[model samples]
Target: LIITIFYSTDNPLNKSAITVPQRAVSTFDQQDLSINMHILKWKVTLEMIKDKPLFGSGIGTFKINYLDYQADFLQKNPGYIKYSGKAAEAHNEYLQMLAELGIPGFLVFLSIIFVFYSLALKYLKNKHNNQNRLIVFGLLMGITCFLIHCLFTFPFHVPVLGSTFFIFLGLSVVYIGGFGLSKVDTKKNIRIKLNLNYLIKKIIIILMFIVGIFLIYTLVFKPYFAEIHYFKGIKYYEKGNYNDALKDFKHAVWLAPYNGRILHALGSTYYHLDIQDEAQETLQRTKYYFNDRNIFRNLGLSYKQSGNYQEAEKEFKQAIYLDPNFTKAYIDLAYLYATQEDYDKAIIEWNKILEIEPNFSEKYNVLYFIGLTYQKKQMPDKALEYFLEALQLTPEGSPIIEEIEKEIYNIYKDRLNK
Candidate 1:
């Protein structure tokens, strides 16, 4: 399995043979493509670690925190083209733990692996009976394989597999005298005594309980509740309850102040509420955590809505600079130009959108807009051609179908009159 995994054309095995220019066009297989994404993920993790070195980004936050640190170059990379969704987990368990739980957590995880191997080896060497020895060897090999696989995949994320793995892990621990403690020897008259330093033990226990509670609340519970509130805000927003959405968004933001999504949502809710200044200020907070094109696009929209055309233009252009194929940015820019009566520039922007997005989902809408732009330019012939093309692209029952057909008929009528 290891040989097959690494020797494939897409994996890093061929990385050394490719020239600098060749690297650009080099195709990575699905597995290797994932590894390429992991490189980006690793960079994000490193940046996240810088901010929260002790506790890292907190539990269950790698996905939530990933986009903020995405490098602009990754947007242009072919390897990342189809890897559209958020990277929820680092494929590598060690790196995932390092990013989410911080250095101390990472070290503790390594210690667990160490203990597993140590006990496995001890059992393998000491077991005399052939059956028991073979069983021990198999368990050792199974664990070794599992750990090796965990290096490149998040097997533990799968519920059934993860449960089974832990079951085996528990069995291993039980077989090895439980929780790193040696088995008590009853035959030897050995008096095992606890070092009873009562006051000191009580203080230590209290301190541990306090620390555990704090860690659980800060890392686990708070983030979970924040996500819940963020989702609630989305639900409210979808129902057109802007005030409730605003309240939930604010609560989410308060809970997860460093969360980019929550902040972005809060800012968007503020914009929906027509509180432009607050929208801008709230969105600005996300800049500290996220360098995403979507966030920039939203920022541009906020500025555009506030009538700050220059800043809006700048933000939209920045979004394009970050992601050359960002169709939404192009559309927004085109509309912005159109609003300013720069029909020529608007048409040019609309054409650029076609150049980048041939298979755009809303192709008919885009064509219809191009037709409208041409009509505004007094080019009836060009307008008619695009309107006809849009008619073909439009779904049969779509409301826009009648509008497009009507425009086509009107253009032809005018031409006949001329």
Candidate 2:
């Protein structure tokens, strides 16, 4: 039975590589596209609007306008045509909405962000209670991270993310707005009812009761349901039954929509299922519940798999922007540029990684790629330098190390013999 269980579990791992062939293909094919393409799209969209900041383009017109603008842009910058195929969306939902939905959508979006931040800040600032302050801080950071990430990717544009965010916003508004005000009113009532010492004692007793109830609810009641659904989702996810996993995850989310971890798991499962759109949407929903960089990285990768390179790069950059020490984004961005044969950009990204992480010894692969790029650029000396650097970084006895050493020797010998 143990053997059977192990085999059954391993089946998903074995078949995972083949489950989404099209997505894999798209990831490989579009991995190396330039980030400039996304920037160009943004620039063209802005230019077409004649610098108007208030009124946006119109609903559903961002994609159309992006394409129209790209055509004009390509005429001026012919190099873009070789890399880009379709006239994609503005890669930025805010900018896209600003262009398409005009001023109304922008204001609505900004207003929502403002409300979330305001309530979170209010709770954090005035709340003397430690527990309430922690919750408020979590919500504040979550919303802030989401908004900052949105500057790059359009996850909020998706219904799942928008709905989830609004739900959290509503919950926050209620929790902070109601509870804080109620506490003040309760204090006033207590003062009116008794002497100062008695009122203080009464408040302490009430707070203690509430804390006890919360502890009981969290420790005894909440775990039973949350654990059951969480495990059920994990089982489905492990078995490669993504539909079942998604249902279970959705149930978990429904039970506790404020749980960021659950939302991230659901979003990741959706991504593995090749439901890129759904994955993007679900992951976006997680912003209200938690602040996890993994979600941003996965969301970016999902967009990349969906042939949305512009959006993918944006998310990757957002991840980096959020935590400059996030090494994965640097590697992914490097891989992205390398795949597109934009070796210069790849080298730039890799160099940035080295700058941020000087001791990142695993960057031999990046060094090798830098060598390859120099070779492509027909700069033999530069290529040789990087090849030597790669050789130095490689493990002493590894086959890859030996191979790199051999290549460096050959390159040097050939150059000297010339």
Candidate 3:
């Protein structure tokens, strides 16, 4: 199925597309960034490990604490922001266990697998019955496959699959014990009557099971459902369906009220819907939970949209202070300055962006904007210099090349007329 999909007529992996180096590079970069996200997630898991090295961050705490770790990672690697939206599970299960459950829990998990293998081997050695031996071998192989899968994927994290595994494990242990109906000694298997003590113990067991189920439902099921809705909201937001996205995000926030990322998403959707006041409030709430530069950038955007230039500038500055490599904040600050006709300050901020991100993806755009800023300041010479540089940097056949050429031509025309 994967092969067929990749080779399908409409797929990017079609032979014709793969032959184009530029297209291949772009495609490869996309995949590369996705793989890098796992590594980035691993780094965050390590942070979780550091935070709770004794027992771990706690079961299911990965999703809860992930945003805080991701925020720290993004500050140092701002380029990662492109792939970061929702928090992620630690793709590596062993690392995840170590981070969440700590060393003792991790060792206990390992011991279970080790015991399973040991029992499988013991059963396999008793080849008096080849059928039972083959069954044991198959069981061993299944366990091996499961363990290997768990290394790369969170198979043990899925409630249904994980429960199935434990069930199989119990069956494997029983088979290894060679338990049989024929060997049941009914006289020795005495059944206890339901006395008061027995009834009390049964009730306690039932209560414990109920409490366990409730905890799992609240901690795991609720958050999982919330994340599903959050992703749906992101899809809606991408499709420009702000109202539906807002509804979905709000539902997610309601389900997982402690989820900082969902709150951030809700706040961003509010900004997109032009509810600047609500956006600011929600984003501020997000900031109270996580100190992420993107949160500040979005807050600044909310302030800017509401025409509160001073507050917007302060937020943008705070964002830059948090992450020096946050080029978007610098661009926002420069744009804000230019909006207020603070041309000289705008020029300085634009230059600072270059200093911080010399090879920024939008370097040409920055240069062109700096040129415009210079032109606004009546420094035609500096304006032409920057404009020409921008023109050279623009892709040969890009529409932006024509725009830069026009800007250069206008500068020359104005000088000639003067």
Q: Highest TM-score, which number?
A: 1
List model 2 lDDT by residue over 1-418, tens digit each: 5654544453644554333444435444544465565666667777656645567655655543454455556667766554433444566766777777567767887887786677677667784689888877777777677766676677766789978877877787778876674445554664445446878899989999999999888766665676678889999888889888888888877767767778899999989989889899988888755555577899999988898888888888866654455788988887777777787888888888777677786878778877877877778789889888888788777677766777678787888899
Instruction: Give per-residue CA lDDT, model 1, range 193-281, as digits (tens).
Output: 76978998899899999999999999999999999999999999998899999999999888889998889889888888889899889
Q: Who wins the lDDT comparison?
A: 3
The 10 consecutive residues of candidate 2 with the worst lDDT sum are 16-25
lDDT against the true structure, each candidate: 0.80, 0.73, 0.82
Task: For each of the candidates, give the backbone clash count.
Answer: 0, 5, 2
Error of 2 at 224 (Å): 4.6
TM-score, each model?
0.68, 0.44, 0.65
Superior candidate under TM-score, 1 versus 3? 1
Per-residue lDDT for 135-214 in model 3, tens only? 77787778778878776578877889889889889888887776432246667998977567778889989999999999
Q: How far off is model 3, as Cα RMSD?
A: 7.3
In model 1, residue pairs whose N, Cα or C atoms come closer than 3 Å (at least 3 residues apart or on different chains), thus clashing, are none
Q: After the best TM-score superposition of candidate 2, give how far the Cα of residue 44 lies from its true spot, in angstroms.
A: 35
Q: Cα RMSDs of all predictions? A: 8.6, 20.5, 7.3
lDDT (Cα) of model 1 = 0.80
